[model samples]
Each structure stands twice: as C-alpha cells, then as structure tokens.
Target chain A: MRLSENRPSPRVRAGRELPLSGKDLLGLLSEVLAKGVRIRFRASGYSMSPFIRDGDVITVRPCKKTDLRKGAVAAYVRPMNGHLAVHRIVGGTEAGFALKGDHEPIADYPVAASGIIGVVDRVERNGRRVRLGIGPEKGLVAALSARGLITWAFRAFGRNKGSVT
Target chain B: MTDRTGLDRIFKPSEEIVAREIEGELIIVPLTAGIGDIEDELFTFNASGRAIWKGLDGRKPLKAIIGELAAQFEGDPEEIEEDVLGLVEELVKRRIVVEVV
Candidate 1:
C-alpha cells in the first residue's frame, strides 16, 4: 500500500514516488525555483555514440522552428509516430530542418516542422548543470560526424538502422 | 535461444516506436502506422505487472527475472515464472517487442 516502502534504493526505498519525470521535474523546478529547466523520462535506443549516453538526464528548452540555430539539439514528435527523438540540427530548413547526431555516421535527412519539440539548452550532469548553447566545439561535432566516430560503435551495435548522419 | 547473431537482425528496417508511462499506464505509439488510424493498440498493466514489465530489458533472461521478481514481490517463484513466461510469449507474438541483446 505504501509505495515508498517497496522501493529498492535506500534513498528511494521508502517508496517515495517522485512524480517528477525529467520533463515535469524540470518545469516544476523552473516555475517554483525560477531556474531554467527541461528534461523528461526518456528511454530509447536510436541516437548512438551520443556525447550523452542512454539514460542520461538532459535539460531541454521548448523553442519554435524559427528559433532553431545551427548545432542545437531538438526533441520532437515524429511526423510518422510522434516518438521523441533528441538530435541536433545539422542543416536548416525553411519549413522544418535536417537533424543528425554527431555520433551518427548516416546521411542528413529533413524532418517536418511539426515533429520539432524543443532545443536542448542544457543538461544536468553528476549534480552540476551543463548548458548546450552554440559555440566553436560545434566543429568537433562535425568532424566526428564526418569520421563517424561517436556513433560508429552504436551504429554497428544499435538496434536502430544507420539512417541519419 | 536468441534468433541469430545481433548482426543478422540489426539492419532489417524496424520502425522506431515511442513508449512512455503516462499517468501510471504504459503507452506505446508506433512511429510508422497504417495511415489515418489515430489509435494504435494499447498495452495496460497493474502496479506489480508494470514492475515486472519494466524489468524486461533486452538483456536478462525470463527465468532469471522470475526468481528476481518472486523475491522482490514475495510471491511463489514457480507461479511467477509461469506468469512471466506467458507475458513474454504474448509480447513476442505482438511484434511490439523483439528478443534482443
């Protein structure tokens, strides 16, 4: 009956159900504590060799398609199924834009504007927050994309096909 | 036994499905569908069932999970094993899931 009582983690063993999924948790803290935040209970195996590994928490900022700049990551509903895919913009589109992960050694494909979710402006790492704003390191991501390094291992091992570069 | 080396099945063009726990229920939205059908099939579960379902990552085996869940939930291990196997069989049949490492 008591939820926390059944949890396995000592801190969470009390069955303290944290209703805050990464997304809701970010929004709640943003409004209450007034700190910019964004995250969600994300689970997927598509994007590979991401500087961000699977199960890592990220801070996303909801943005408009017009606001998307080169080298910013966005999460959006797939035009087909609306599955949330977190990837960075490699090329710009007047309607939507093209997205590919730095680790993905695939070609750049365009997604419709409707599929766009939000730009990931930051991520919470270890206990500190890291912001993902535009910068020079963008070149590194490109070179890796060219070499197909970050995503090479995952592409060889990922469940998803090597579709996007 | 697994179907094949993870390589043979890796590039067969499987659609990406979005699954999430919304309001205590797990919802899987298929990214690619049969056109114009707004509602896809849904899978529902209770609290305990959800716990067991969450444990079904591509890694662990069905038998191992039964023993783990029995201890965690304080249930009959044999009975739980049957239940877990039944669920896995159903999931595989539906094509919503695949046995993978």
Candidate 2:
C-alpha cells in the first residue's frame, strides 16, 4: 500500500548560478585555466564596448606569454586594485604590454606577462557569435585605441550611433 | 533501510568538474563541452552538503560515510544514510559523481 512511504528524499540542492566578486571570480578562472580548461562568463562592463559590450558572453582560453600579440583582447589582473579586467593589447613595452579600453582615451599601465590571465577567444551576444572586434582588423583597432583615437574616430565618423564593431 | 545496494559503493567527483570552497560554501562548475560556463552552469553546496561532499573521497564506502556523518552530526543513523544515499544518487545522475570500480 505504501511501498515508498518510508523512503526519505535527499537534501542536497544544486544551484544554477553563484554570484562572485571580481577577486573570487579571477581566482576561480586562474585555477581552472591553469588546468588547461577554457572558461565562459558574461561580460559586465562597457569598457570594451562595440567589440565586447556589457552582458556579452566571453570565452577565454589558456595560453603562454609567448602567445600574446598586439591587438588581441585579453583578460588580465588590473594592477591598480588587483581586480580582473578584459581589454585589448594596444602595444608593448620593455616592462610588458599596453592595454586600453576601446571607449577610453588612455591606455592602462604596462601589464607584465604574468599578470595576463587568458586571451578572449570567442564572444557571444544574443545567442550569436560576434566576430567583428576579435578578427584580423584587431591590429588596426589596437593601433587606433593605442593613440586614443578610437573613440574620436567613432565620434568623427558618426559610427558611434550604431553598433559598429 | 530501503535500498542498501549502494552502501558499499565509493564515489568520487568527476574530473569534468572544478570545485572550490569559498566562504564555507562549496562551489562547483561543470565543464560542458570542455568549457567552464559559469554564467549558466554553476552549482553550490551548503554546510551539511559540504560535509557529505568531503566524505566522497573515492576511498570511503557509502556505509562508512553514513556512519561518519551520523556520528559527527548526532543525527539518526537511518536519516543520515538516507541523506547520503539521496545526495549520491543525485550527483551520479548529473554525472558529477562517478562510482569507482
């Protein structure tokens, strides 16, 4: 009559998502990428707008320092506060590499190779893969961003009105 | 008291998962298609769940785990067994836990 009435259910509950601080997320990403695994998370800012906007899903792959190149978008630990940041590699110096946000006028301080976490390999928006900013034109974009001319060019050409990555 | 068949089995967390304990909670991310998609596929366990998770070391049988938990938590042995077995079954179903041969 009550064949399963004596059975007790499991109490373990699995959550679908967990919110993490910048430091905590970077810690997890560093650990996972060190294991040669790739990670994907939603982007949270507009610093790399047009190319990588807010709420875009980004995939980062593990790479050695030797794999870094100018124009490629990378995730690195910001020296200012030790938080994680994703920006474009605008140039390189003896100290390290120069990174700048596409919409910002200034380049961040040189980031050592060790501070670079991983390279952004893919970006997705609205279930579609966005390919404009991370493509071959990245070199030109980096060059423009390095000179603090990206935003100016967008404003001058009236391309900032639409998504012109 | 129900199904005792799984009592002697030992289960280990799958290699496809990356787990870390932060702030007394166990956070787990499963690598789907070789990518750790934290935005949509993340899991967390509470304190008691963490205790059970720690006992699944691949070297301890379910019976021993149940005994240890029962002793540590001062709960009924039968209730602990049910909880452990229930969690293990769920983990196994999700492919997050694998039974060691």
Candidate 3:
C-alpha cells in the first residue's frame, strides 16, 4: 500500500485538525516574545497571500517601536477585533502606524506603536529560508507590493468570482 | 524519613515555557526549540490543569501544590497526589515543567 493513497483530502484533513484562531496564536506569540524568545508560527489566512501564502512558516523577532517603518512587515494587533495581523507598514499617523496586507484592498485599523509586537525577519517556504528586507524574493515581493499589484489581483479574482468580501 | 515518590520532589515552571491567560484560560507554549514551529506546539490547560500550573512558581513544593489543589477540588488526598504527579510527570517529559532541587 502506498502512503500517498492513505493521505486525507483537504476538507477531511481540515476537519480532523484542531483550529487555532489568529487571536489565540497571537496571544501565545506575545507571551513568548515577552520572555525574550524568537518564535515561528504558521500563517493561516489569505489576507497576506501571494507574498505570504497560507501555511507558510514565518520567523519573527521581538522588535522595538523605533524599529518599525514604512514598507516593513510587522505583526500587530488589530484593535477592532483584537486579532493578530501580519501586514505591511504603509504609512504612519500621529497616534500610531498604518498597516495593510499586501493583497488587502483597504488598510486595517491603525495600531498604536505599542501594539506592534514583532517584525518578520524571515519566511520559510518549501523548506527554504527567504530572508526578508534584502534578497531577490524580497525585491520581487516588495516591488509587487509597492505597486499594489497583489491587491489588484485579489480584487480581480473576487470580482470574477462575484464573491467580493 | 521522606515519603519518596510521595510528593517530596519540588518542581518549577521551566523558563523555556511561555504562558498566557486568555479569556480566563491558561495557554502554554514551550520555547524549547527557538524559532521552531510554535503554533503546532501550543498546550492549553483545563481548570484543574490551570490550578496545577499556577502553583509551579519555583517556590512551592509539589506537596504544597497538591494540598492546595486537593482543597479546591473534591477528591481523596492520595488520588489527588496521584493525578497531580501524573500530570507533572507528563509536563516534565514535554519540557514544560522541570524538577528543581
């Protein structure tokens, strides 16, 4: 018997696996960071897709408020829902910083500088470490993100499917 | 004479374990392997587990913890000791808790 034949389908696998919400993972991440530890967690949503696909592993390190800047990817708590969001820092406000997913249409609710927990330093995809901020993958993704092509693509897909949310 | 395997050992919460209280539940994440996949490693504690976890503050003996838990919960002292010891042993194996001198 082949092992591949025994593998469960996506729907069945999803059902068998326990679901961990973004808020739950973020709560643990925050505590680990507070203990001065670097943590890695799997990404689970399509908000930051293409650049960060679902199931991709992300390595994040504790960061200071001064370490954040526009164009950087930071993990922050969305005030509206208290859920964690890993999004790009597009701009800043007097109160805090503005964030948006690379493929999101609109910016999320502004997160105060204090609410920002860690900055993503590396992303693991297909067992390879793609360092953020400097590299070919970074350059390509940053370019795509800068021009908002990913967001445009997402919107187009939603429009075509008539499932725009 | 010490009871030996009868709650003489003192254990403390491992520094490698990071815990959070969310919505009145205790969630523990063991940071033994730095930068490893952590979402897959989270362990949430139940009401009884939470009681045992909170008492492992590096200063309390296992016997003291058992006494407190036994008072809060309804059970025989020997049975409570057995359950607490079993849970602690499991946590020790997972590196979430450590036995201290």
Candidate 4:
C-alpha cells in the first residue's frame, strides 16, 4: 500500500472551519494568547444569545488580572470539567469573579483569576460588528443579570423569543 | 529518479505563527495580521504533514527531509519527494514558511 494514500490531505486555506473539541480549543486558545496575539473564532452556542448568537464571530484579547472587572465578557476555563466558556462577569466572589450567561438564570461557579483566559473584545454577526453586550451598558447588563432581572426584563419587553429565559 | 535540483534549499517557519498539536493533529494559527484570525482562515496538518512540519527547523535542506521521511516510511522516494515539495510550496505561498536564502 502507498503511504499517505488514505491520509487526509493537509489544508492551509481560508474559509475552512475546524470542529475543535472543548479541550482542543482551550489548548489552542492558551497557546495563541500566550504569544500576546488576539484570537478570533466563531461562537458556537446560544448561551449568550441576542448579544452573541450562534455562528457569530468573537475576538478575544489577552487580559491581565486587573482587567477582570464586572460586566466584562470573558473566556475562562471551567474548573469542573476543564471546558472553556465565554460569559459575562456578573459579580465578584471571595474566590474570584462570578460569571453567568445572559440567557441563563444562575451564575456559574466562581472562577479564579488564573482560570480566566482572555476577555472578549469584539463580536461580529453577518459580517457586521456587534456592540450590544460589550459596550458601556455592560455594567447595567451585568447587574441585572446577577439579580436575574435581565430575563424578566426581556420577557416583559417581549424580546424573550428565541432566548433562554 | 526525481529531479532533486533544488533539494538543497532551506526553509524555516515564520515568526508570526503559533502551532499546537492536539489529538494527534497539528493546528497552525497565523498572526500575519498581528492577530490570531482563525475565524475564516485556519490551517491543519495530519500525521504525514506533521512529520514534515517538524523537520523544517531552518537548517535541514529539502532533500535531507525527504530522505529521512523515505527511510522511516515504506514508500517510493519520488512520491515522498513530491509530497514534501508540494507541502512546502503551499507553506511558502501562505508565508507560513520562508526560504532561508
């Protein structure tokens, strides 16, 4: 049999999307960010929906510990399973910062500063830039999300369709 | 016999790229734009490609790499040379690897 006959051809082209597992993604993120370079990838879930919808592209920049402020959307590694998540910083806890998905009801377990990877700097949808949850109003959004009022407000305003409440 | 005229050319990986191997695959993230923009552009190499990539240390010539790979795998020397040259061409075109001359 010929060697490499069955092996997949090497690809180094544009417009190709690699389906990376959570672990693989975390490894890639850590490696790229450590080089002081920003990374951009398509968001995969609706957990931060309406603001960051599925298929939206997000740019994450290397962040220092002092940058972990309330209302900032951060990419972090979950301690429970070592999976990576991008959520909003809802509040501060004794251990670290509290993170929560805007569409979710409760905040995730506190993530230590070291567990935090980077901060989301930009979001794009349909080739256009999105500045909804990453703007100056982020503080207000975080406060409401922490109190579990953002969903109620969305429901009250009839913007709850297609969003987890 | 394969045409080995340019086999002595040396090439090295660019400084604007970061690579990592996960699950037996090599993932290359390019920083050509000073940012890791993999949203639309991403590069991945399989086992064969990974073997070739590891040999590009800015010191080894193309012929040496092809010889090493030929000795390790059961394949025709000419075909192995073709594969290596083909990959190097693509890498050079994308600025991932640059000729050391």
Candidate 5:
C-alpha cells in the first residue's frame, strides 16, 4: 500500500508570494453581488478546517470600513502587497476588530478594520452550499467553526507538542 | 515611539510604490523597507490622517504640511502638528518610509 500524504501541507500566513494587484482586488470583490459588491480569492491549508478547508474557494467582497461586525470572518489585503489572510474576529471596538486563528489561543492583531474586504457569507463545497452559521461546529462549515478549540485541544493532547505551531 | 529622522516628509509616489484602495480609503506603501513581514496587518486612518497623507508631495516640509492642512481642516496647527507628526512617526516605525532628505 502507498503511504498517506502529510497533513497541514501548505501553511501560508497570507497568500502565495505573488503581488496582489488592483485587478486582483477587483477579481476578489466580484464574487459577491452574484450583482454588486464583489471580491477575488484563492485557497490553501486546513488552518480553518471543517469551516474553510484546503482547496475551498474563498469569496472576497470589497467591504466598507463600516460593514464589518465582531466575530465575523474577514480577509485582509495589505497596502504594500496583494496577499490575503482569513481569520475570525474575537474583539473589536467601533474602530476595528482583533484577529486570531480559531485553533490558536493567542490573539494575532487588529486588522485596519476599515480595509476588510468582506465577511465570509457562505462556503461552497463541490457545488453545494453547506448552510452554516458563522461559529457552529456541525454544519460542515460550522463544525470547524468551533475554531481554536480543536487546535487548542490538539495542543493540550501533545500528540505533536509545541511542534503544532 | 515612531522614528522622526527616517521619514523624508516629502514622499513621492512612483509606479513601484502605490496607494492601496479599499473600502473607500487609500493606504500608501511608505518608502521604507521590509514592511510586509507582519501578515494580517491592517492600518486605518480617520479623516485628518487621510488629509495629512494626501499632503505628502515630496516637497513640503513637515511643518508646512500641517499649515496647508490646518487651512482646510478645523484644528489648530499646533494641535494638528502633534497628530501629523505622530502619524508619520508610526508609519516610519513600521518601516513604511524613510525620512527624506
């Protein structure tokens, strides 16, 4: 029998090193609006798992600074480059929200809050919409939505130890 | 504290460096170095910060930048100066730009 492939294959912090461009930005925003607010996207890794998986297509919408809400999943595109990141919001003020991987215990940072493109509206799997609420850990999308809990559990297990990071 | 001497105060945008347009706002890649290391980084500005950034034309002195700004906006130059300097300072601290000569 052939050996199985390793898990967590591509752990990218943002996106491929490719420069994100205006066209790319437009491409990302276009996914919304099936009509108007649009966005562009790409996918990799299982960091968000069960909710967003490896090979899952992420839809990005160019969001107004005002559109973001606490606990919403958001994509952040920086000024100097076009790479992107998707994370959950735990804390935020009227200004912006703080971000972190659901599986990780530590808070990463607060994104500009204003530059947020769009919150993840839904996830598509093999042409099917999995009908998921943002944080549930059952509806395929929501199952993994439990987030940092599983990663934290995995860490507590020490099956891999500090190596998990 | 953000660096004072690093920013040229007169930043000129070129093809390589550009403003990031998102959510009806613009963010410029300051002429600093390796500012892209921190992933998921997002910086925002209030209305006044936006005005100060637009004033950066690579010719105006930091002081003058505030004066030109005070005329259109409501704050006193002395007060706005602090905010202006602070914004530029933080931008510099992030390695977004070097103080121009």
Candidate 6:
C-alpha cells in the first residue's frame, strides 16, 4: 500500500491562521489533559493505518495507567523527544510498556506508566463515530499488533481494495 | 463599594484557566467547565500578550500592572491602561481572571 493513501488532501487556504509546530500542539494537548480535559484532533500519518486513517478525528480521554492493556491504542510521550506518540500497546516489560505503530515493524522505546497521556476512546471516520474499548476487535487487533503482523494485514487489505476496481 | 483603582486589591489568575508557554508563545486554555474540551477554541498570544499575562500576579493591583507595563514598553500610560483594562475586562468576563479579596 502506498504511504500516502487515505491521507487528507491539501485544500485551498481560507484565511491565514497562526501556525503551530507539532511540539507546541502536543504541549497544548498535554496541558489540557493535565487539567482533566478530553481532547480530539484529526489523525495524521500512517502509523496506525487501516484502523485510524489520516483524516479520521480521534477523541482521547485521560485514563489510569492500569486501565491500559495489550492491544489497546494509547497516546504517550516518547522518551527520546518528549513528543506525543499514538500507538498500540502490544505488550509490557518490567520497565514499563511496549508500544508500536500498527504500520511499523519495530516497537518504540518502553514508556513508563506516567509517560502515557491518555487512551483513545472514540474515532470518527466518514461522518460515522466508533467507540473503542475492550472487545473482540480490540483483542484481535492487539494480537496482530503484538506479533508485528498488523502491517502485513493492512497491506493485504489495501491490495484487495485496490484490485476491486 | 471597593475602589476599582486601588492597588490594594489582589488579582490572580483564575484556577479555571490553564496556560503554558511554548517557544516563547503563550497559550491559554480555559477549563471552567471542569475540563478543557479540544473541540473548544484556544487563545494564543504573541509578545504583547505575553507581556500583559506575565503581569497578572494575584498580588499586583490593576494600577500597578499598568505602571509596570508602561515602563516596560514605550506606550503612554493612558493608552496602556486602556488596552490593559480592555483585555483584563474580557478575561474577567470569561472567568479567566479573578479578583482576590
């Protein structure tokens, strides 16, 4: 599957708005979350493809560290850059937890329970909204993400979709 | 009635408002409704707004804040007071700024 597939296309400018860097946006997100806020933003990138499209809007809620389980999708701070990263919790380690992008093969640096910002609760796609929680779909996705096979599945789905024309 | 110009009244940032500084820019988010909803709009400030926000310590009076701002920038005290008062009034209306007893 092409990397840019399912991405939001560039649109014409309506008016000039102050530009915010990714770091600034994440910092703002963290600040609001600290204040017990729930936030949503249009998804970007292909890290969690098929499950979460680039233009899909996601709603995240503050959650307890213990609430997260393997195969759950979460937003966390990357230890290396202190930036926000959204990925699936494939498994856990003695240090903390192991997280990986659904589209990437490698697991990211293990993040402490405190490093997690929130858990995704809802995703809106094509005017339809779906709530995410412990369920069969979550379990299956978790299993696939844990084994690093989600990318392959996504690729297969993409090829099949492309051939449908 | 309390004198509005008195420097004795304390003015503090409302607990309902949360703010942060990133890359020299001030970002203000209001959490009055218990939590900040990302769907709500956010307020961002540049250099001038930063200057005014930094002066909102609960201990400082409105007059004193105006003086400090006037000394820091080249604007006349009258103009500064007008601008500061306008912004502070808006903040008060939004509950982003509160008066201390």
B1-101 in candidate 4: lDDT tens per residue? 32325898888988778777655667777887768887777788877887888888899999999989898888888888888888888888788888776
Candidate 3 achieves a global lDDT of 0.69
Write model 1 residue lDDT over A45-89, tens digit each, in one string.
446334555544555555764657666677654445444567767
| DockQ: the better of candidates 2 and 4 | 4
For candidate 4, list the clashing residue pairs, or say none: none
TM-score of each: 0.40, 0.83, 0.67, 0.82, 0.38, 0.75
Candidate 3, residue A49: how far the Cα is off, in Å: 1.8
Ignoring the other chain, what TM-score does chain B have in each prediction?
A: 0.69, 0.89, 0.85, 0.87, 0.67, 0.83
Model 5 C-alpha lDDT per residue in residues A64-134, reported as the tens digit of each score: 55556555667765433545566666666655566555554555555675555566656666656644436
Chain A TM-score of candidate 3 vs. true chain A: 0.71
The candidates' DockQ values read: 0.02, 0.29, 0.15, 0.47, 0.02, 0.14
- The list of candidate 2 runs beyond 4 A from truth reads A1-17, A156-165, B1-5, B46-48, B73-76
Fraction of real interface contacts that model 5 preserves: 0.03
- Specify the highest-lDDT model's number: 4
DockQ-better candidate, 4 vs 6:
4
By summed lDDT, the worst window of 10 consecutive residues in model 4 chain A runs over A7-16
RMSD per model, one decimal:
18.9, 5.1, 8.9, 4.3, 19.1, 9.5
Query: Which digits, one per residue and each the tens of the lDDT, describe model 2 over residues A1-165?
Result: 121233432233323245577777898799878878899888887799878998898999997876699889999999888999999999999988999899776888899999998999999999899997788889998998888777677778786566644
Instruction: Point out the worst 10-residue segment of candidate 5 chain A by lDDT.
Output: A1-10
Whose TM-score is higher: candidate 2's or candidate 6's? Answer: 2
Compared with the true structure, what per-residue lDDT tens digits does model 3 show for residues A1-165?
111222211111121144556666777778878877788877777777665667778878889766687767888889898888898877778867878787786788778988899988778877787554323354355456656676565566563243222
Candidate 1 is graded, for docking, as incorrect
Maximum-TM-score candidate: 2
Give one digit per residue, the lDDT tens place, for model 6 in B1-101: 56665445557788876677645645566775555543435566545555666778887888887778777777456767766666677777778779876
Clashing pairs in 2: none
Candidate 6, residues A1-165, lDDT tens digits: the string is 211122211111111133556676677678767778777666677787767767677777788866688877888999988878888888888988898887777889999899998888778877688553234578678778778776576667664343111
